[model samples]
Target: MTTKLPAAVRDRALQIAHHEMGHYVMARALGFVTGGVTLTVTMDLRHQGGACITLVRPISSIEAMKEHLEARMMVLLAGAMAQTFPSKPSAAKRVDKPKATAILKGEQGAEQDYAKIRELQHLLRNIAYPDTDPVSCERIAAQLKAMTDRVWDRTQKIVEDQAEAIAELAGALVDGMVIVEQWGRAADTYEVMYTGPMLERLRAVQAIPSLCVWTDSCGDAVQHWK
Candidate 1:
């Protein structure tokens, strides 16, 4: 017998899928090795909020680490960014009063993402400018935001292109056929694993391309799709 999820449950599943897919797509674009992406839903009140986790390899060097953290921050922001900046709208359209207000208000999990971004920013600033004063942190934050904004358009394109893959992953989650016990957790929360050939299939079906082209400076200066 097929089971039907409640409307709320279904909506939440889609939300989690998009959020998780954002991380997965960005990580791959940045050439990070991902173990997989997992989406777990539980009935326990303590864990009522669903989670979408992307497993990635550890960074190897200080410079590489900074780039990795920045990439991760952008991926973290991508979920809430999608909620506020729909693909149909351009940056100009995003300036409308209602949309701008909604973006400012943010969406679920946005606080957690922002907190992570702030932590990464603090670390980056400390390493890059150890002698910087307190006010410089705010300045650094703005620069980080500006950099993130520069890539928002490309991020939206990736999200749009990978929509079918995301939905497929979400459907698999709802069907309960892809459960794996989460690592380091005593509780029996299950998550779907998308790794190796499975992940390649997802990317292939979507024909997703790199989100940016690196320049000689090693910065993502161009957004190219295949």
Candidate 2:
């Protein structure tokens, strides 16, 4: 299939291979398993969530919690970060676009997902999106940039200090990708297993249903079932 990437994305496949490798391995070193990096998808090939590393083991501890939250967010930002490469119009344009699957969906899907993204932006501004802070909008934007920056920094360390773990986790995630989406394991792969401490704090200490569990599509179809 044809794509709209710039002509200057030298070594297109190589950069994505390493970028994803960084995320996949970094998550494992932080204690969560993830899919191995892929070379098949590159600057030219990556679309929305094109270079995702299926997270494994989830975030369930303190250090692991911090690392996981920062790591995944960084991985989400990798697409934009990578665009800061051989060109400007491409880099600037790519950086401005949303870096998630919902962003790539059609107009209605983007609209549907806008609520969540707006909520994310709002919480990012307030830090209450996940109980981080209630900073002003400027501060929130700064914090988001800072957090993603940290993720990028730590991702480098993860690649350097934990290459083997990343390779292993990536392999495991890729092996399980079929079941990753099929067996109600999005949480296990993305949401559930990677729960941050704030989530745990809310659930265990605060005793709230902040993150409800909908085990099935059919359940979602019937509001009262869950």
Q: In terms of lDDT, which candidate is strongest?
A: 1
Q: Output the worst ten-in-a-row residue range by lDDT, candidate 2.
A: 205-214
Per-prediction TM-score to the true structure, in the order listed: 0.59, 0.35
Cα displacement (Å) at residue 201, model 1: 3.5
Tens-place lDDT per residue, model 1, 1-226, is 1245445544555556555665665566655555555565543311122233454647577766666665666566555543433322122212132442243245344466667766876676567666666777677777666655544554555655555544555455445523245678654443345554566665443454555422432545545432
The lDDT of each candidate is: 0.51, 0.35
Off by over 4 Å in 2: 1-10, 41-52, 56-67, 77-135, 160-226
Candidate 2's residue-wise lDDT over 103-189, tens digit each? 324331233333433344344334324655454567667776665454445433333333333333323322222112335533212
Residue pairs with colliding backbones in model 2 are: 25-166, 35-170, 36-170, 58-193, 58-194, 59-193, 59-194, 126-133, 127-133, 187-192
Please estimate how well model 1 matches the true structure, expressed as its whole-model Cα lDDT.
0.51
Off by over 4 Å in 1: 42-65, 82-107, 126-131, 135-148, 151-168, 175-197, 203-206, 211-214, 217-226
- lDDT value, candidate 2, whole model: 0.35
